[model samples]
Target chain A: SQQGEEDPQALSIQEGENATMNCSYKTSINNLQWYRQNSGRGLVHLILIRSNEREKHSGRLRVTLDTSKKSSSLLITASRAADTASYFCATVDRAGYSTLTFGKGTMLLVSP
Target chain B: EPEVTQTPSHQVTQMGQEVILRCVPISNHLYFYWYRQILGQKVEFLVSFYNNEISEKSEIFDDQFSVERPDGSNFTLKIRSTKLEDSAMYFCASSEALRETQYFGPGTRLLVL
Candidate 1:
């Protein structure tokens, strides 16, 4: 598996439902971040969780990181139709370059 | 809120032609990067620039590719000769610090024929 790989390549849910996506990495990282991409658009930073931090939240989005297992999960609560997009997990290498290694993203479709 | 901005949202060029994609990173950001995503594929990092020099670049950023910070606000990615495989969405991102959140611009779609 690559350094950053997201499982459940695609997901579908209804409005107000919760969507959870998981990401697993293979090496040490300075931090892990989540990004959202609408169809044919650019990426938007959602949240960042440092390797030493267990969990972090921003409004309806919650992100948890487990350095022990080298895995992270993003949970979007009360998902709205606007939340329908592809969610990607990117890891910042601990080498201090700040380059982002991204995963194969999970496409979430929230239907009204 | 400030955001990175890219020019010519879309571009099409001949395979052997040169293309220069331009970006204006957030004014106050210090670090800048370029990434690309082939349709339906994962986003891949191309290069990172700081202090008017390339800090690190991926293997994909080969001899044909070059980056320049011509002035204070503009960062440009120039491809001396493009290939069909070069067709992808190129994104420009900037951050305040090395480990900080990187804000991305609405990518520029390049199609090489």
Candidate 2:
């Protein structure tokens, strides 16, 4: 079963604009990570925020996790045309096994 | 930087035919995993491998599915029989440890006719 469900199934923005994507999950999670996937390509790990950590940043990427809400959000600052891709949020549950459950993903189109 | 790699960017097989997907994870990584994404669907976990054994697998991984680390550098996922419903993009990933950030391969697009 899919754990995370990203909001704004699709987002269109212009280059240099900011793009934000939200993900909501149902169960308790050990951690949450965000990834980018170009069309027909593999996923690229962006950033990960542990349950204990409220927020994390890497380069132009920012990720925040709220355990109380069982949700996380990814923010791309100063987005570029190259940043146009599908963004997905993956969660690892605090359960018997360590497995990642990914969301349907948000398709962001950054027009140049 | 080292990245995971997979062979046969694309594979086409007929229903009931067997197929094997190969992967070479980044050296020094202790954990490996397999995932599949059907077109227009979320990426789904198949199984996780560690210490030469399967640590976990999803219900999608049935008796017809198996995983093997044939050599120090090679990991393979075999399907006993392909089905039309099996068509999807299969990806291989590796991480330093369980629940850690994972690096994914380019993925092999499988088409079952």
lDDT of 1 by residue, A1-112 (tens): 6978997899999999999999999989999999999997999999999988999999999999999999999999999999999999999988758999999999999999
Q: lDDT (0-100) at residue B49 of candidate 1?
A: 95
> How far is B60's C-alpha from truth in model 1 (Å)?
0.5
Q: Write down the worst ten-residue block by lDDT for model 1 chain A.
A: A92-101
* Separate DockQ for every predicted complex: 0.92, 0.89
Candidate 2 local Cα displacement, residue A84, angstroms: 0.4
| Model 1 per-residue lDDT at A24 | 96
Tens-digit lDDT string for candidate 1 (B1-113): 99999988999999999999999999999999999999999999999999999999999999999999998899999999999999999999999998899999999999999
Please write out the lDDT profile of model 2 over residues A48-86, one tens digit for every residue.
898999999999988889999998999999999999999
Give candidate 1 regions above 4 Å deviation. Answer: none
RMSD of each: 0.7, 0.9
Badly placed stretches (over 4 Å) of model 2 are: none
Docking class of 1: high
CA-based DockQ, model 2:
0.89
